[model samples]
Structures are given as structure tokens and as C-alpha cells.
Target: MITEVAQIEVLPGHEDQFEQAVSQAVPLFLGAEGCEEVDLQRSTEQPGRYRLLVRWETIEHHTDLFRQSQGYQRWRALAGPHFAAPPQVEHLYSVLAP
Candidate 1:
């Protein structure tokens, strides 16, 4: 599986609104074809910062499939406005060896 981590920065003082929007938008990820799981975490030190973790069957599932779907559009519509800037995203995988 591949894990997609998105660093989201909310506008100053908009943390609460951003969180609410993301909560309502969670289903967009949950209902996607190749998404296995999704989670959102807020930074204690920086209230406006959030980290979104999404596990997918493959990288393509996120980059090619989900990004190209209408769900992506809905996701943006739900929470995009609260963003201070575009989320910075990266993909990761578990290492078999230490």
C-alpha cells in the first residue's frame, strides 16, 4: 500500500472552519475506488496546520484515479476555500528492512 501525506495549512483563525469542512469532506476519500483508509491530524503547536494521511492500494489510485475524478472536485469545493495555500503532498511506503 502507498500512503499519501498532505500538509495543509489553514488561513489564520480559520482552523475551526477548516476542520469542519474537512470532516464533512472525509467521505470523498472514504468512497474513492482505491482508498483503503483516511485520517486527518491537527498540529498542536500550529492550530492552522493539518496533516492528511490517506492509504491507497497504489500511488496511481491517488494521483491518476482520484485526482481525475469528480470526487476530487467535490473535495476541493468542500474545503479548498479555507486553505491558505495548496496542500503539499507526498507519497510513502513501509520499509521491509530497518
Candidate 2:
């Protein structure tokens, strides 16, 4: 499995709204093909900063499938407004595990 990490910065004073939006969009990821898990983390140092973690069966499940699906559009529509700027995203594979 691969993990997609998206570093998002929300506009000042929009933190609560952004978190709510992410919560509302959870089902979108859960219903996506090959999507195994979805989670969101906020920075303690910077309340406006967030990390969106999504685990997938493969990278294509994210970049090719989900990103191209209507759900992705809906995701952006729900959460895009609070973005201070475009998110920085990356994919990772685990090298070791317990």
C-alpha cells in the first residue's frame, strides 16, 4: 500500500470551517476505489496547517483513479475555499513496519 500525504494551509480564521469540511468529505474518500483509509492531522504549532493522509492500494488509485473521479471534484468544491494556497502532496511506501 501507498500513503498520500497532502500538506494544506488554510486561510487565517478559517481553521474550524476547513476541519469541518474535511470531516464532511470523509465519505468521498471511503467510497473511492482502492482507498483503504483517510485521516487528517492538524499542526499544534500552526493551527491553520493540516496534513491529509490517505492510504491506497496503489499510487494509481489516487493519481489516476480518485483524482480523475467526480468525487475528487466534489472534494475540492467542499474544501477548496478554505485553502490559503494549493496543497503540497506526496506519495510514500513503507520500508519497514512493526
Candidate 3:
């Protein structure tokens, strides 16, 4: 599996609302084919910052399939308004798993 890590930044004063939006948006992430798991975490040091982790069966499942689906559009509609800027995303794999 591959992991997609998204560095999310909410607009100032919209932290709480952004979290709420994420709660409602999670289903869209899970609804995609090959999506294994989704996790959202807030940064204590940065009130408006969050990290979103999504595990996928393959990179293409997220980069192509999910990104091209209607669910993605819906997700953006629900959470896009809370964003401070475009999120920075990176894909990762376990290199030292035992």
C-alpha cells in the first residue's frame, strides 16, 4: 500500500469549522476504490494546520481514479472553503517495515 500525506492549512479562525468539514468529508475519501484508510491530525503548535493521511492500494487509485471522481469534487466543495491555500501532498511507502 502507498500513503498520501496532505499538509492542510485552514484559514485563520476557521480551524474548528475545518475539522467539522473534514469529519463530513471523510466518507468521500473512503468511498473511492482502493482506499484503505484515512486519518486526520491537528498540529498543536499550529492551530490552523492539519495533516491528512490516506492509505491506498496503489498510487494510481488516488492520483487518477479518486481525483477524477465526483466524490472528489464533492469533497472539495465541502472543505475547499476552509482552506488557506492549496494543500501540499506527498506519497510515501514504508521503507523499513519489519
TM-score for all models, in order of appearance: 0.94, 0.97, 0.96
User: RMSD, each candidate, Å?
Assistant: 1.4, 0.8, 0.8
Q: Assess each prediction's global lDDT (C-alpha) against the native.
A: 0.93, 0.97, 0.93
- Quick one: how many clashes does candidate 3 have? 0
Q: After superposition, how far is residue 25 of candidate 3 from its true place, in Å?
A: 1.1
Q: Write the per-residue lDDT of candidate 3 for residues 1-98, one digit (tens) a residue.
A: 99999999999999888888889989999989999999999999997899999999999999999999998999899889999999999999999967
Q: Please, what are the lDDT tens digits per residue for candidate 1 over residues 1-98?
A: 99999999999988888888888878889899899998999999988899999999999999999999999999999889899999999999998875
- Model 1 lDDT at residue 61: 96
Consecutive 10-residue window with the lowest summed lDDT within model 2: 89-98
Best by lDDT: 2
Q: TM-score rank, highest first? A: 2, 3, 1
Which residue pairs of candidate 2 clash?
none
Better of 1 and 2 by lDDT: 2
